[model samples]
Target: MSPVNPVNPANPANPGNRVGPTVHTTPKVPVASSAPGVARPRIALSTVALECPDAHELAAFYVRLLGWEVEREDTDWVKLRAPVREDGGGGTGIAFQSDDTYVPPVWPGVPGAQQMMAHLDFEVADLAAAAAYAVASGAALATHQAADDTRVLFDPAGHPFCLWAAAGAGDGADTGRG
Candidate 1:
């Protein structure tokens, strides 16, 4: 879909809130419809979208780190999906959209800094291996760590995510997978 202008008319309550363009998306499965003329809409949470300087570039990093497939793509937008399960159901997804004005958010936010909005979390059996793989996939280890069981890393576009070890794996022991 072509990008639309992001200037919405101002509301009295929300003075300068610039609403983003509406990007059309399709549901993974058909949702039940409301009765005709009911004016009700069924809503479901889909992928979590991130703003970045380059959609495809950041998406490539995630595709490597998470081993998810590209479900959809365009010049300014890309969507990724985890591999389908044996139950034939689609896994969770994420999307990236290009924004020339995108600013990378900072972790362990400081005053006047671009504070992190939200972060992704992945449960890992071997925290050491997962953290290593994430670093190799273009993610930089964050300077501040808040928890023993979680390692904070920033994606190529500066979105923070955690590599969390399962219970009792807090020491980040490495599995000899090599």
Candidate 2:
């Protein structure tokens, strides 16, 4: 018989120590963890999806408002992607899906009536200019004004969104909450 390999675990040469095959284990990495030395959870928002009666209408409103392009579109669903940065980093995506039973949220969200589940908030340099643009783009200004700094407007689909004047932005306006 030929000489047996010392590294082989089945070899009879070493009774106490034997090696068959090397097994490497990868170190476990945390999928969701808090920031290093911080107690708060670290999470990133990848996309903000909304449901609308007409996906194209809502998508077009946002596309014109945010200057984002439609990355994907169909009869049932549409996705709008923000422009990429100069460093080639990916931008946020906003998706709109068609809902046949979609109901427009009532303005000023009454508890007894159809309350708004959620709404979008936009920070603009000039609230007046932005509001004018939005109104010109088929968005109607809401009669109920919660704050002077914020201009609440309803999209063509009756979804309420706010245009807040950001501090140290294009044109400094009232720093009120929307």
Candidate 3:
């Protein structure tokens, strides 16, 4: 077989053995606007769901850490009450759903199963106390870099999250990157 056309060829590997030059074309389709004008669906960010091997266990862990109450519970889904302050603004609600084949994430460069992505920061009054409490409550200390004011923690189910003391507002100093 001869060499196919340098620019375009029906089959580069089997030139002349195949059909004519293959033409590449883009399909014509209408692009929809993501912005809302008025007719778009009244969509709003509501909740985030995390898949866990055991929804009950994970939900309990969050409730203990955040002091959030269980809003709803079922075999497959569990929703926790959103953390609200006296001022009204606060953290969002979290949900956990059972995933039969769920495998916890592993730290980057660590061998074995690993979590895909996880990083949640909680502002606390006492960073050391809170970190200690979390460690006592079943969360494992993933890492503690002196340069970063945040400490990485893994929930009982192995989901990774963090605890960060509010900057300049609490006794905890900003050890994280400025």
> By lDDT, who's the top model here?
1
TM-score of model 3 vs. true structure: 0.69
RMSD vs true structure, all candidates: 12.1, 22.1, 14.3
Q: How do the residues 22-96 of candidate 2 rate in per-residue lDDT, one tens digit apiece?
A: 223543454555667879865677678888898998999888878899999998889998788899997668889
User: Which 10 residues in a row give candidate 3 its minimum summed lDDT?
Assistant: 14-23
Tens digits of per-residue lDDT for model 1, 1-178:
3233333232332222211111235544566667667877677667999999999999999999888989999989999987888999866799999999999986665568896777888878777788888999899988877555667889999998887766666454532221
Ranking by lDDT: 1, 2, 3
Question: Where's the lowest-lDDT run of ten residues in candidate 2?
Answer: 14-23
The C-alpha lDDT values of all candidates are 0.75, 0.75, 0.69
Give per-residue lDDT, candidate 2, residue 140. 95
TM-scores of all candidate predictions against the true structure: 0.71, 0.69, 0.69
Which one is best on TM-score?
1
Clashes of 1: 0
Residue 48 error for model 2, in Å? 1.3
Off by over 4 Å in 2: 1-44, 86-91, 169-172, 176-178
After the best TM-score superposition of candidate 2, give how far the Cα of residue 159 lies from its true spot, in angstroms: 1.0
